[model samples]
Target: MTRTPQCPGCGREDRLQAVPAVYLGGRDTVRVRVRNPDDHHDRTVDRPVTTALSEALAPVPEPPSRAIGCLGVLALLVAVGTFAAGAGAGHWLDDVPVVEGGGVFDENGIFHAPGQELPTAGPAWPDFAWLAVISALALTAAVLVLVLRIRSRRAFTRLTSGRAQAERLWSRAWYCHRCGTVHFRDAPGEDTRPLTFQEFRERVWQEGGYGDLAATQRALGGVLSIRPGQ
Candidate 1:
């Protein structure tokens, strides 16, 4: 059994494979490749050299789920619309009269006799208009609640999937052998400007954040060296 050492990059003890040497500028360098298929973490690091070739420790970034967010908003709006329409229909139906048993029932289903307190009341009957309105509103509200819950859950699932994919792709760090500078592929702190290896070296050592290339290399394990001049 060939025992591969723990990965220096992500620290996975298993499933580490030694990849073919990559010759850049005629320098043959060995790399160990390790990947977590579940999280989509795929990266290759130098065999044993230190000096932090890349910012591998930084957390992976997630992607924006604009479409999922929009769908959730749309579902909420539809639920509100359904509730409003049910209420409006009920209000309209409440003003109409009904005829039954050779007698006319008013909106409240009460028969009023004249010359008795101006409005007389007899044995009260059930009111069907308000009942119909209430029933419609209640049924519509229930269905709206169910639909909103389902759609919201679906949207959340999709958003989480998108974030996972983004993290996998952007989290791994990259090393520029020519410039000897290490930077994260998609880290938020990355610079947007186009810079050569020399420019990157100058910015890191002389500008700010991290200064003194020699000191940095010594501190990080002394795997890289600055060019002869600047």
Candidate 2:
């Protein structure tokens, strides 16, 4: 039997126990300890606790994680396809202005419609039209993909580490070692730039509405290092 310490949180004696059951550490970290001031043998662990217990404590899940793979893949593919199409359209096709309506051209050089302007078949129409469509679709897809990848990576890190208040925000975000925030195996744009602690604290204070004055100041000092001069 391992001798446990009482929770400083609830002042219950004996390893993870409290005179009265209370939440502590992770979920199971604050286990159920029956306190019998009269008895020396009483204790219990109620639930099957795991690491996720601590992760749930984060203020927000943060970015990118809320998104993931397949969608990112599809967007990348579209961007490639659209860019190819745009290139083909812009460079290969010859613009032959035929007409500008949806009337049926009966194979002959004659147009058949009361007042509808005929859509003239241009030489480069096939190449240019397809290219343009592809390019537009592809670019949009690519942008979406890039954004999602960035976000998912960030989220995954947050999920794993449920970072503490004192930890350098920039340190965590840049070296998100757990989720591999910076390491890219020969992938494009793998170079990660981490914000300094000061920058991080400033950004958080200004952007995120964390209204804790002590926390805000601590973040600025710890993360940003606001030593009097530099």
Candidate 3:
């Protein structure tokens, strides 16, 4: 009941396979990966989900959140200020005595006023050092938060092109050549369909969005590696 195609390279039906891949996020393109078990040749091709394909195809874009970025920067500044204040306190404490009762000082070391009792000795080191350590930890956490916030903002604000969107919509697939040129099939038992690179240059110019295919390609390229291939 099912008809299968043979591999063009080896003329064998068992050596060819077609796999179908789909992306459900935004785009509606199907990608077919064609493979030949004999020679190990592999190729991936994209096709529109619908018969009428647009030149400028893209997914919905998410808006940027400036508020989050501002908040992150504010947090970072506050952390730095806290650390600086702690450091200043430590420096100021350096001049004060750390004896049991906290002694007083004059130009020549310990001061003994006329009939004044000397203060009790205090701890050897000032407690300001603890403040500095805590502040340093807070600053480190703030820096980490700031970095994450900036990365998230860039992700939301970055532009995605039509071509890249189209690629996202493509389905994963496999294929093998039959007699003439290469043909694609969803599975070994399914009927074969002709697969070829669909150029959107003329259609892009006529439809609306991009002026040419090159423009579409450029627009699809992203500044970050996380986005789809351009």
Candidate 4:
């Protein structure tokens, strides 16, 4: 069974109901559904986002991948550069043995003194090689953080209409909530995609639900007027 978890954003006992799953594409938010207790009205409506604090708690969508790709490239370049610095320090700065093994004590090879090991150890590499590695990695981290911040900012604007969609939704849901009056103009959108009552609650509530859950309870109260507690 699709049991609902209380919304972490709102701290309500309501859960995700099937039939009409919430649609979350317009503003790049991970939107979800909320509903009245045990009420199953098969109508969908958009809700304004009321609780700024609660809305802040909702999941933000991922930033565009191009920004992420650039960050990865920066990280890879840093890794390669650091590795090269270490390799160069070890190979060029340090002295390797001239002879493969103790062949002969001659000009072509270095003669080891009595009771000595082959390929004698040399001076340790400079500490500056390690500093190069650290510096490169730090630059990569800074670049990635900047890109993420920019992308997230752009995504935030998409949730609210650019004044156009709002005009449309307002034109559509143009009925008095206090009374059971209907709108003069027909809701423009087609019933193209039929949603369950639970899904309907989630989609419309994305905008308006957080302001006052009590207001929602009141709006729904009319539908559920028969029940004593409703």
N/CA/C clash count, model 3: 25
lDDT (CA) for every model shown?
0.40, 0.41, 0.43, 0.40
lDDT of 1 by residue, 45-122 (tens): 877342222322111111233565555556556655654655565443343333335454356867645322322243
Model 3 C-alpha lDDT per residue in residues 1-230, reported as the tens digit of each score: 87555554445675344322111222467899888788899978887562211212222222455676666567667767766776675553444433344445644587654445544455333666666666667667677777877787665444323434333322222333232222433433423443322222223222332333333343222112122111
- TM-score for candidate 2: 0.30
Each candidate's clash count: 0, 23, 25, 14
Backbone clashes counted, model 2: 23
User: On TM-score, who's better, 2 or 4?
Assistant: 2
Error of 3 at 25 (Å): 29
RMSD to truth, every model: 17.6, 20.0, 15.7, 18.0
Deviation of model 4 at 62, angstroms: 8.4
Q: Which digits, one per residue and each the tens of the lDDT, describe model 4 over residues 124-189?
A: 455556746665675667576667657665654554333343334333332222222222124454
Which candidate wins on lDDT? 3
For residue 131, what is the lDDT in candidate 1? 45
Off by over 4 Å in 4: 1-69, 92-117, 120-124, 135-185, 188-230
TM-score of each: 0.23, 0.30, 0.29, 0.27
lDDT of 2 by residue, 1-230 (tens): 94443222233322222201211244454468775667877877565462332232222332344245566577667767766666665554444334446655656667666555444444444555765676567667667777767776865564435334323231223212122111112223322343333333443333333423224343221222222112
